[model samples]
Target chain A: MRNWCLGVLAAFAMLVGTIMPAAAQLHVDVTQGNVQPLPIAIPDFVAATAGDETPAVNIAAVVRADLGRSGLFRPLSRKSFIQKITNINVPPQFSNWQVIKAQALVTGEAAMQPDGRLRVDFRLWDVYGGSQMLGLQYFTTPENWRRVAHMISDAIYKRITGEEGYFNTRIVFISESGPPTHRIKRLAVMDEDGANPVFLTNGSYLVLTPRFNPTAQMIAYMSYISGKPRVYLFDLETGHQQMLGNFPNMTFAPRFSPDGNKVIMSLEKHGNSEIYVMDLRTRAVTQLTDNPSINTSPCYSPDGKQITFESDRGGSQQIYVMNADGSNQHRISFFSGRAGTPVWSPRGDLIAFTKIEPGSFRIAVMHPDGSGERVITDGWQDEDPTWAPNGQVLMFTRSYPNGRADEIWSVDVTGRNEQRVNTPGPASDPAWSPLIQ
Target chain B: MMKFSNAIKFAAILSVVALAGCAEKPKAVPAAPPAPPAAAAPAQVKTSSIVPGSAEDLRVNVGDTIHFAFNSSALNSTAKATLQRQAAWLQKYPAVTVQVQGNCDPRGTREYNLALGARRASAAKEYLVSLGVSPARVDTISYGKERPICAESNASCYAKDRRDVTVVTSGGATS
Candidate 1:
């Protein structure tokens, strides 16, 4: 799969110097309590050739959608543009954009190269400062325009917010259908914006909790095959799946290590589930937790020095942290509700978890030491929280109060801009992949 | 006593049929008349009246499922009584192998509920073993909250969903 997509990004060589000595005056402070969307203008990209018209228009539309959905940018209507951009090389007319309250502007062009490849160029401009913030060029196949569009979106987003963009990512989730009692769950993958979905499994068996490795080329999930629940690895490149091990009991709740060389999961024997880690290369299994209670959902910190998991050792389910070698285990969550499914953020600053209250389950986050806990969602049942690669946002599953629908939802780490992500059908247990290479 | 009597009668009928066959010369013997359809019908009905160690027998005659309290795997008196019946049934058919499936309500998280379900299944298996059922004859699996018997969000439905079910896997009546 990697080889096939390699041709799309055959040469990403930088064309011009990217340094801009002039500081950018137009920026969006995402950390503020309440953020007002920055009004920006993104007109249709110029098509250099007759055959490049559709790709140009589509690419610009996708970029607009990506930024608009982030709740940080309000893309102005194309009809509102006073000056039509016919050439990306020329400077934009600042007065025309300023009249429409546009703080920032993006201009780009798509052309078909003589070598049978498509060339795309984009430039982000600070309209108020009248200075160009970013300019880049990409060479790829025509069919790969969506990915190019995402790259452009990320470029603009990073320039304005001063944080890494999560637009260029994928989400691995479980697509669910049928009745609640007899649900059919298949492993599915799609873009971060819920586009170009493809099911990885046939729904012949129940699959749950799919997570991507750091490279996003492999997935680890729990499947009920032959009436036995076990952990399995699915290779995205080869389209092949194999059971993780020949354990004598059920193995589930699997997660890859930060380094992507080992998988940590739970193994049940004689009714007790304990945490275990297995090296992907040597297939050597090591027991991490020896407790008789339930210890599952283990996740490694960004530095891979410690692990955080949920356990019932204290008579109720709660989040616990321990060294990577399973020593010095201690509880970190002390709250009114039971917390489980704790996931360490990639930034290593917070841990996302599912907080089970009296009659509802909400998505919450807390620091490594368990202080400064805050609930970020108000769904009746929101669980299985997964962080974006940048750790600035989280995606989770929310089941309606009527118990009929389950949808994927995302929210910023600041507990704002909550929105529902579109899916083909009922979905759950979403895991966001790292930004694609 | 009833099983022994039936076995004796069946043996006598077999011996008589064998003697009759021996009396006839092998070369000139005609095919024996098919046993009266009526005679076979009554015997079949008598045996089919109660499949002693079948899944339906376990479900209808002896309880095949036991309920558990919310997040509690400790067997109550009623659950214990049902397990006692299941243990007796298993003992009567020593060749039978069974699997106990633990299920949970939708109130808990998926991973935690799975562990709790495992506890529920093993609790039932241990009880059956204590009642003299061989541990080798039993296996256990946890469905977690994935396979809910009832989908409603009411208390009674949740009570029904939190259960341990005993299913005969092998060595039972085919029907």
Candidate 2:
């Protein structure tokens, strides 16, 4: 009886031991983590078949560039890549990526199909877990191989940020070059990463403040085409254009009403700038302000009923508000600094403006009631603040003191993540469009 | 576009300056003895040009100035007197239309300036309307502080830009 009891006890002990080891392996107690940009090592995609040169290498460079510009990923350089990604089934040397502080490692292999297509098979591995999170493969034409790489980057960004990737988006702005006095402005569009820059409007005429319609295919801007400053619209897909209205005076600072169905602008008639809204479909005009003050730079609220514009009627340039139908006008900005160029965010969360304080000017954001004002950027001259599609960032133009040139820059809403975007020429008046789903 | 029309526009602009050049004190011209209201009817049919010295010239020139009361859109007694003189000129032409541009001193909100400028212009328009002058012969535009008479920044200068001028828009011929 005693021997039988001991035998049962021993079996129970063995079972507990087995379960204990499994539990220890499954449980992880990490509460805090590296919140910094994820360090990633991208191995060159091994090319199975040569294309043009002696041999075509992997598309790792394209992937690396895409990830680096995301402002969220730090890709390790190839010079430090410990091992080549030659096989799909081989496990990565996780220790090597760790030595280089790469929290994530991506490996891929390229093969040429008999049908004259290139197939890229890739994998993403979590360095800390020593496990694979994703394995994806894409087939594309050799000429479009870059797209395949961008798709890979999108997948990685989505998995990490839990947000849709903006890799394939396009940005349109006024391509400005030359001195401020002789500024040659043209409409330019390019990929969000400053690639494939295409000039939409030639620099023959003066163009200022190009804003993208919600569709990203239409642009409304102020142009001196008819020898008068007026608002004009251009269709990206149709390549057709039309003037906004036949107003007698110069119409400056034109922006699309929230719905893109109307344009809100300041019309300077008889040297008095007053806000006016024009219906796109009906060619109807509604005057929002009858007062004589220089009421320019009209921006509609998200709901389109109220418009905030800059006026010097009170002696100094300040912001004012009024109804869409031009009633119940009131003062909104009691701040000391001079505020001009108020732009309402798409989300209706904040209004961005350029405040000229003392001898300096800065870009700032404030709540609708003119409270909780905060300046986001400062320089010799930084104006024309436009928000990104997601409201997560803002882009504006900054010119040096000497007024040598201007460049477009972007900064995250937190005031961090400030970076200058590359452009072929001096770019200004950057208007971010809604995400082109 | 030859010569940019600069001379014609400049001369008309000069008269506007000249009208504004008067004084901070409001002055009134003699009323044209109530022209029986029928004479003012043909005055409404004419397309008066705002040339510097035309028969319909009503605009004050660039260097000209007008004054408003403290926070008041009502033309002061002095300003009313000036409008009287202005009214006599409008009656003498009989074929002229004029625009009264009203401005305000820089001590209030811009919306108020816009409203105030309108009120000041309307006040002048009302006086002209009261002077047996047909309202149809006059128009009003308020340029809050956008077109200041004085380019400098001081109380004296601010006071100067805070006034209005009458621009002739009908029968006029000036070199």
Candidate 3:
């Protein structure tokens, strides 16, 4: 018995040593290949049941599209696929993926549940290493299967990138129609890929600046609902809305706090506009700026300890930062022409803004201390920039001279990979939501 | 260019209909008027009245609007002269309440232009008040780039858009 005990102790010690080095073998520093996209493969998901064949195909398609658009992963086309996935329940044929030169492989199976739900199980494989990197299952309604796909894509993204996933997210923007001067603006919501567009408001009133909460479940926007422009808070789950404050004047440019416990907005008092905040729980209103100059477009830092805004007090519209309590105000932007609509990045590293020059409006970013100014876009008008959840991309409203809000475009912080964010109509004031819970 | 100002007129009319007693509600675009099909009458006829609310009434008589330098809210000589005439007209009509609407060329940032438009309107209203028009009789609203008189993005068109226009809400009792 004593000899057996000693042998067990030796085995346990050896096991700890083996596991430590094995776990360290995954030297996945996703940030190292910042300039190069990782090569990935997603063979069509296997359908356990005959009726779920379409969903299995669709799930793979969406996953491929999501990964492709991220600017991080390159999804290999099926035309180049060497293996047809028939059994996702078993390990993938890694040698076949290796021949196709795929570094990573994704396999999944979809089956209809007994009560009309869809059960999807997927695994992420490190093809070159011949190992399973991630495995997860989702059970959801058939109608919401797309959301399930997004969630699955998000899980794989997080596991590989070692970062948060913004795939399962949405954006709320003002969908615009009609001529430039007679624009018909409506509040609209859609998935981040511009799918499932839903208009939340009829063309009854002009709406602007739709902002999403931290959880992406609620939004706060400005609407001229009663001929008086005021801010509104909307719930995605219930679709109910309530006016935010009893401002006797026009209130616009609403934004949510990092925690979604407060809303910061601009209130036009008499002839001057100032920044104010409203607490969601206490219904308490606090004035954040009190100056003769207009202090509009207020945004909070990711930590919520500081606020960045634009003020014209210094002769021209320049960016300013103030403490959450409205004290310690100082200017951050000092560029030619003017700058407005300052938004802090979620990573709290940079502040994106609209840089107005002679006959040009550019989307640019600067450090929080007002250093390292770099304009990412060049157009006649590119204004009101909002950051993606990952803080790598920015979406802004772009239009030419005399052009009606033409298009919504996004550019990476590195200023490459500029592309239009697809929308139903000409759109503006886009606010990206955080990853869905 | 012509259709836009008419749309503004229609927006004003709809603003009155939608808000009812709140006639002072600034003419917010798309305020229950998705299709502004009926443009105003021909410019010649509409631009002929000395009576308040008439295009010519405000234009031919009080010099309806004033323009500013690019990205500036400070009044220029042309703007001050226009406001002086507006003040004199307001003094003659004791009951007239004018809403000084500040506008800007679509050249600036939306929020900054809104603030600058407010500054332009406020600058004009202050000049009028200083010239003896009652402060209570004037209210200011900034349209920013939301309402542009010219749809083109040239120097002349943008100049036309960046002006403060005084619109009469109610004609005062004539002396």
Candidate 4:
């Protein structure tokens, strides 16, 4: 530990061109706090300008909502604040926050700038140590108040949790209505908290499995536009839709590469489906698997060198992994039930999937090598699992046996904090978007 | 092309007439067709892009649908027999083009069921081609578990849902 501190101090000295004390006092042991919600205080942000009081209160309210919904932090009520702060420039009154049982405090200020953008400044403080944990400022349009609030929440989250925040992300899913047998499926996008949902395509043609590329502003999904299933790419900014490429008979379950330059999906020809990758720039398609059995739902490892997917070559469905160039194909999931729709975590440690047993379909996670398998949800019929960008949460669809009431639900990776993600109505096939840039 | 059964058509008209009576009905799910309303006289009406000819006759006589086992797209002897009959019916109207729609039970993941449904449709198309039907005349599509013939969550409904049906797309003339 001393050597690590000395090494860090040396690196810091080189960056600052000065010698510095080697002190290692910054670390959060998050492993122990899994079950207990962190106690925090979010006092109403003070308005720098006299007329911007309402926006300041809203900014603090949004941060509280984002953190509260995550189930990680419990924001103490503003009624318990013992000290009234009028500005964020001064250090927090740590003794007052400590008396209220708040281990952390988040304070900020907002003002309307001359150029018409709202300037939001925030500081996260540790009550015990009397230290500023995080501080940042953002300039955004006046209409982008929510975005500025999300940025502040993200910063506070990172400071306390030692992980990236998924608050600024989005979700792409299939919104369903009508009868169970003949439902109308349309593509919809929304914020991580189910706000500002925009239906991308009308129900003119059926769409399925909308996967967003974390590295770019693109969505690869399957559509039945030509009376047959094929993959299509939708540009988020311009809203241009185009067929991925002129491929074989059918293409389904399209997922983007980790770098967003290629798409790995399944192509069926002559009654056989296999995995394939198509380069987005050249439109060049390459066959990854030539097996006679079905291989689909291919997801890339975080490093973009390996792919994990499901295949039926051995008999029933099981998860398999292969190189990016389609070599060394082997099975990763081998259990009593059938596993499909395997998704790798951004941290590259675990893979989440839908596990089917005798009468139930469950959402489960396992190590990359298929050990430490645990079911996160005791779901009656949960399918389509997606990781929350931070790799700490999994969201999937839970439905009754009749396929009537399908709703998206989320659970922490440790199998606790299970809750429903509210949407407009019956929604399915949710894919999480990467953290907003 | 889409085809509506006469039973469904009559039920549609009946529901339209009864709409005034049950204006306050809490219809969360559309009332499903019960027992298909029996084999009424064929509608013989043009709807969507459908034309009345061999497709309607084949649905009534030779049975345009073939059932498969759970999670298995392989054709059994009974399925082969049904495909043989469908192949003969198609040979009667050689100019007609058809699409075999494949479906599955509501037990598996949505995307895999789509691929499985595709396999089932292609299996039916291959069997038809083997029985002397022109390969170019048959196109295939898999609705997966999306368009189930039965909506219940029982074994019998699942059995009915895991099947493929051949629908005539073009070149069928009314006679």
Strongest candidate by TM-score: 1
Instruction: List chain B TM-scores, each candidate.
Output: 0.72, 0.62, 0.68, 0.69
- The residue-by-residue lDDT of candidate 1 on A160-256, one tens digit each, is 9988889988899999998888988999999899888889999999888899999888999999876899999999888999999899889999999
lDDT of 2 by residue, A98-117 (tens): 88888888877777778876
- What's the lDDT for residue B121 in model 4? 95
Regarding TM-score, does 3 or 4 come out ahead?
Answer: 4
Per-residue error for A112 in candidate 3, Å, reads 0.8
Once superposed on the true structure, which residue ranges of model 4 sit more than 4 Å away at CA?
A: A1-33, B1-52
Report the C-alpha lDDT of model 3 over A89-153, residue by residue, as the tens digit.
67778899988888888888889989887778887778877777777777776766677778777
For model 1 chain A, give the 10-residue run with minimal summed lDDT: A13-22
List per-candidate RMSD values in Å.
8.5, 18.1, 12.3, 9.1
lDDT of 1 by residue, B1-175 (tens): 4466467678878999999988956686788988765644433334334567887778778898999999889999999999999999998988899999999998888888888999999999999999999999999999999998677788999999999999999998753
lDDT, model 4, position A30: 39
Put the candidates in DockQ order, highest first: 4, 1, 3, 2
Give the C-alpha interface root-mean-square deviation per candidate: 1.2, 9.1, 1.9, 1.3
TM-score ranking, best first: 1, 4, 3, 2
Model 2, span B1-175: residue lDDT tens: 3234456567878999988997477668776686664544443322233444463334442212357765566567777777887777777777778777777643333233544566677778888778978888977766543344454434676677678777776665453
Q: Scoring each candidate complex against the real one, what DockQ results?
A: 0.48, 0.03, 0.37, 0.50
Q: How many clashing pairs in candidate 1?
A: 0
Clashing pairs in 3: none
Prediction 1: B-chain TM-score? 0.72
Q: What is the TM-score of each predicted model, taking all chains together?
A: 0.91, 0.63, 0.84, 0.86
Number of the top-ranking candidate, with lDDT as the measure: 1
